[model samples]
Target chain A: MSLTKEQCFDQLLRSHDVKPEGKSAGWLEQIRVEALASAGALNFPSAKQDDWRFTDLSSLFQHAFYPVDSIASVKLADIEKFLIPDAIRLVFIDGCYAAGLSDLKRAGSGVTVTSLAERLGDLRVEENFGRHAPYKQDAFVALNTNFFEDGAWVHVSGEIAAPIHILHVATCRDAPSAIYPRCLVVIEPFSRATVVEDYAGLNDGIYFSNAVTEVVMKDHAQLQHVRVQREEKNAFHVGHGSVKLGTGSVYAATSLAFGARVSRHTLHVIQNGEGAEMHLDGLALIAGRQIADTHTLIDHAAPRGRSVQLHKCIADGAAHAIFSGKIIVHVGAVGTDSVQSSRNLLLSDKAHIDTQPQLEIFNDDVSCKHGAAIGQIDLDALFFLKSRGLTEERARNLLTHAFAAEIIAKIPVLSLVESLGRTILDRISGVRT
Target chain B: MINKESRILLEVKNLKAEVAGVEILKGVDLTIRAGEVHAIMGINGSGKSTFSKVLAGHPDYTVTGGSATFEGRDLFALAAEERARAGLFLAFQYPVEIPGVSNSALLRLAYNTLQLDRGLEELDPLEFDDLVQEKIKVVEMNPSFLGRSVNEGFSGGEKKRNEILQMAVLEPKLAILDETDSGLDIDALRIVAKGVNSLLSSDNAVVMVTHYQRLLNYIVPDYVHVMDGGRIVRTGGKELALELEARGYDWLRAAA
Candidate 1:
């Protein structure tokens, strides 16, 4: 009672000299520390946290020091090596501005791409800064929105054509452990752009990537956001990306994750305005003891909006895959059309997939459907393919790769798609060609 | 190549099979030698398809009793794929559509499996493409067929030809064409029949099962067996097929 409202944050970090600054980010960061510290026993997975029961995350917190260091030592040429040839590359290291390596064009008088430090005072940033994130509810999200060191904000001015590809690479090669690369993309009215963001690894050292991407689609602006996360199997990754759709605007997001030891992505897309649309599709190829989780939410706040969520999982060896998707068609969201599908194919008898596809609709004049299926390779199809003279193992690999290829090809980035397709084919089929 | 002393390449002895607890192929016996095309003609529900499925090792049916020997090896000891690699191919009456598996890829896998069994070096994609392009002409299939998924959304005539394309790829010692001409128009049937006829060799054999005799006009058979009540009721030369078409299956069923 003797201190200001930021008093809670001061106590948690009292042991260190990293005091809060006066910038907009510093203010938000302080709020996150306070909120997380005061989340008030809301919930913690049991030592066997039912949902987190399978994942024992005690090792993630065991590492104490994490410093931001993907600086000048991490050269632009080095980042170029991972550009996935032919892809529109945009690179970010250690969440800061590396201007020599970014290719971004200003849009229609209203759009701009600038460092978060420069846009700290921009009016739009002030308005949409942390709008969708529930700082007081979720602990980790509040923490991310609080301590994000440096990121970019992309703003589209008007009716534009062409896609935007943003590549985020965490290149911290020493000094400490973690790197958080964040981005914010804002589309103005009637503009359209496609952005493919890549998350890659350059070192064999263990690290953590806690990224947050916020996308705002204004009236009539169409945006396609494609993200690929290919971090190391030794890394720990947690990312939250949220989008708010305006009236008549369209948003499509496709994400592919080749499993890390623990990679979890929590995504939400809200159709806040009428006549808006959103599509979310993700595919994960998991092997060894790696774990991948995709949790998504589609909120139809206005009437007559459209939404779709499709997630596919292929688990080999002793890997695990999880998908939890929820769709909410509010009472005011009449005439909404939504669909959710989760399809999983397990290669080993010990491989596991936990999927729950659910829907909560309050509007009567709406169409909502959900489906989920987890099964082994169809023995009949396998036998049929094998009876043509292919070995049993070869037939199984071919059918599995075919199933995953259906979704990966839709990514549309070309080289990366094929490279990842080949990797997945080799891992699943255990064949070189 | 199959190392069997017997002149008959395929010999069935009192083959007993069942589906869902009901017996379909009951105590049936037959034999076919190399360089012979034998046809099994039967009415609906007379168990003509069951014999081919039992030979193909379709898991749905249980072979309760009896045995089938193909190329001197016990066909019952092998699963469906092993039997195919050992040179036994069954041209499905209705080939299944694999939504995302390309026809070219499937053919390459099939062809390599056979080559491996014969102790020949396997062909990769590029080499397999050169080999497959030639085989496609046998079925008169379009070059574009190599790019599309196997049997997915294909028309009736196209599916039957695709089955023959698989037979061409595997080059089985004993080719069992089960109702291979059922859904084809007259023109498609002739093309498929031509493809099947070209594959006939002195060291290999073909077994054609069909209800209609129109297909015989394109590729003549060496022998024809009229089946009724789960057994061969009549056996004769190629003339029997023409005689059955002239007289109809009712006469053969009554003769049983």
Candidate 2:
């Protein structure tokens, strides 16, 4: 019989020889051991589970992928194209920090940006790392905690003049490998920052990129986080992110997923203090036989907290997209206002979309609303555009681009918005009619 | 007026069409010539709207047995966009609303496309803005409407007026106004009728489909056809519209 996922993971972990050392090694070792034990006890969710009903991860475990212990040889020049100009950049390749490609000098006094592996001795790292995103129940998160070699750690004390860009490039050589990328961002009280987590792959190979990000926002802190995933079509990507908001803190996040054969993103947010606000926006575009799934949860634990979310998916060819968003308002979270909307556009008869937007409120004074819709292109609108002398192809492309622009426009970075807009347009135009 | 010497802009012979396998237009035959305004007056379900839709190559309607030629070219052989590029414009009865696309963009695109089709110079956005400003006066439209989305949240009068503005911009060889007067107030009707009058020329033709003779009051028709039971039973001069209005379509149906 084939080995279970836990057995495979245990075997893979035993084969790696690197061990934590130095002054901060004790806590790191404890975290690693606890994560491994939790991962070993929990089973991988199958298709029979309600949350995994629409997604099948059987094919993902079929291949034997070991931890990438050392940095793979990747040229900085090759990854220069993925860098955002005029921004503080942290570049990581194969789950290891690439100092030659990063702009470490640009990080001034108000901002602190470094690899988490290098800052293991920092007291703040011990306080915030793995605190927001618990991995006891999630196999993917637990695996990332046990195997993450290096990732970006950003701490903002005051205000960051420019956005910080973290670029994760995956390059596989010789064997099908797996890399765990971790990110921890902490915004101190009365501070503000914008962070972009961008993932891109170089070559076409079988690789697994399991990533986790934890964000902690103090009182009155403002943070805008954007995650962009554009991996190779042959890669597998599973990412988890968690955010905790303090009193009067504001957190806004936008996630865009465009590539990978099978990808999933799970995001969780909690308003821990009164009057904290959260805004979440996401978009996924997939074609061919690709599958893209997104699951999000927002919990309002304090009074007068507000949250708004909008998620959209565009599926063409035989691709499938799944979205599940839930908002929970606890009994004491009075006057909480939460809204969630999910929209999907199917471009072909074979394309499929499953969306569920749910709201669970235990407070009588809370206002919560949720909406979900799945539809094809509007025929009336199509005919209207065609009758205006545009070719049917151009008309369809224009409408499809407009549908995606609703989310792309919400991004604060102008250059990133323009680049993502062009990418989405090109993909929509390339979809076969 | 229309005469035997005038150039024939559109010729329809035994045109039979249906929508969703239900026959709507049964053997409709009408000929329109240049420098003339023809009005097809009929009650509801008299196949007047179907004839216009079929002529414009709407995909929902299938031409089972018919022949429609526009300036010696087979109209049924082209797609909806091709028919539009060929200078056949249809002012829909109920104009569709596209939420995100701006009105100015749609207008300029249609204008530039027709210009390219006719080997004319295309205007840039600034130049097109000036031209659109000049044409909007025909319907007394506010310049702000051009900046908004195409017909999105527009009132009935505004949508009809927008349709006429499009016709003015495209400058088609043959324009079909399908029930363009149905949902308009008296003021909007007069404005729309006057816009159609100003755009008329000896090189092009207009076919106005209506159920009332009020629209023909401001823009008189050269030829009027009374339709009933999916066929035109009577054809006469502009006076036929007045007679149908005064004595209703039942008289014509009984006579046929």
Candidate 3:
């Protein structure tokens, strides 16, 4: 028999994952072992737990547990069905990066896109791998570290103009599959690149894609990271996209969610250095009983950093949307300018959206503001448009499109935005018609 | 005075109206002959606006009793949009705004709705644009206005002028201006009043609803009716408006 639950728990005690930080390299095994123990604790969130209030967590306990495995059968042609060319594409199978199929040469010498296993084989890790993002007491980040054996290792040199795209294809056929797809991207001083975390599922079976993307950009480096989730509705997805920006570094991220029955995408960004800028734009079009939660945190550790966040949600049927964004400014982080807004549109009366935008500023000389609005379509706008020669159904479709366009127009890719726009129009056409 | 051979444009008998379960117009009566310009001046909350809304069949104002005859048809029986298509129009005091609905699209709808109502061929976009240019010029409105969303960001003056433009396009037999002069400046008032005058014909009638005596000087109603406490208390010509202006609505109410 493989390792039992108690043995796994005992092994976690011996691992470095359980040990606290700065305790030396001997703590690595302890931290990893403690991560396994934390998973077993299964901390049940109650009314006191504010994050999972809208999402049902009781059902998670009933699911049959299985170890995270890696399968090799999934082909490239099957993955190619979801690929959008011109989008810097990096394909990974199971937990390992497939260099034979991936196109990373145009990325140039200024960029380093390699597999985590290869980097480990070559002993190329100069600094700590999972040091900045510790996984001690936190169960989820710990889980990420426990399964970090086969992740994508990436680096963008300073002053580089090109962007990088990383695609994570989570597949489960016959056996219960689970993989922790981690992204470790380091941007040197004054470098610029766009990193994408595109997650797509292959089959109709129940799978789990628990991912973590950790980024650290040096001074004057700019990075744009997009996390797109298009898994099956039966899939379970819980992810974290974390970042630490140095002085004069610009960071922008977008989380597009249209899959998974229960999916939560977490973002934690820190303005560690001054003169930095950050923007987080998220969009989710949820249907059926799908649940999508996007929780973001922006910490202004230094002074003179600017940030703007705008997230829009369109929920239909009984689908639920949850958005909680927090911006925290440290006491010395003076001249910190930040603004965040969340707007949600519920198409059906049964559909629900819980949006929260909070700002906690300790700096005296800083500008910080946040707002959230949850409302249905204006009925008057519908009748007015219908009276103008358009049919009643067509009129409502136009108004809903206009409401969503306020954010979709901000996307740099026109064709993708347009196709997404049309898809949204078609989805709501039933209500108007 | 109205022309005898032209048709009885509007006939209402015992028109009752209530708002939010509170009866406003107990039982009102009014009639407008073809080509006649009728003025309705009232004290605050005398149910003047309610009367116009009742005639337009606004869903909020329930018609508890009585009937309105328009061109020999039962006007109280139709829906709001149908009433508008059946040659009936109410220029609201506070016109509602639609952010993304274009003004040109709204005008086309009104034009086509009336065409369907009158059993005429519908005008296509090309033909409609051609027809609207003449009406736009007649109202002295800028061509750029057509590109804007319907009343989305219109100024006070532009909204009233837009109301008259709708009236000009619909060409209703009996047009009710529900306190349209409340927000307009002198220039906007003159332009709107001129547009109304141009639309006036032997086949159409105009009912000017106002609280001030100033608008009467420009519109020049042939007859003026004083309304107080939910009823018309006094009836006279242009002198009544001038007299009310000089001595307030109390003097007319006390005299009648």
Q: Who wins the lDDT comparison?
A: 2
Put down candidate 2 lDDT per residue, A1-433, tens digits, no spaces.
Answer: 3556666566556634553332336788798888888877765666777777888676577667766766677776898667777788999998888888888676779799998988988899999988778788887788888778888999999998688999999997677778888899999999999999998889888788999999999999999999999888888899999999999999999999998889999999999999999999999999998899999999999999999999999999999999989889998999998888999999999999999888888979988888999988888778767676778887887788778888888887888998888888788888321
TM-score of 3: 0.75
List the candidate numbers ranked by lDDT, top first. 2, 1, 3
Q: Which rank order by TM-score, best down to worst?
A: 2, 1, 3
Error of 1 at A180 (Å): 2.6
TM-score, chain A only, candidate 2, equals: 0.95
lDDT of 3: 0.75
The per-candidate TM-score of the B chain, in the order shown, comes to 0.95, 0.97, 0.96
Model 3 residue A42 CA deviation in Å: 6.3
Which has the greatest TM-score? 2
TM-score of 2: 0.92
Give stretches of model 1 more than 4 Å off. A1-81, A94-118, A158-165, A170-176, A203-205, A430-433, B1-29, B43-47, B59-79, B112-137, B140-144, B185-187, B201-203, B211-214, B226-234, B241-256
lDDT of 1 by residue, A319-426 (tens): 888888889889899999998899999989888998988799886999998999998888778768767866778788888888888778777567767777787777
TM-score of each: 0.84, 0.92, 0.75
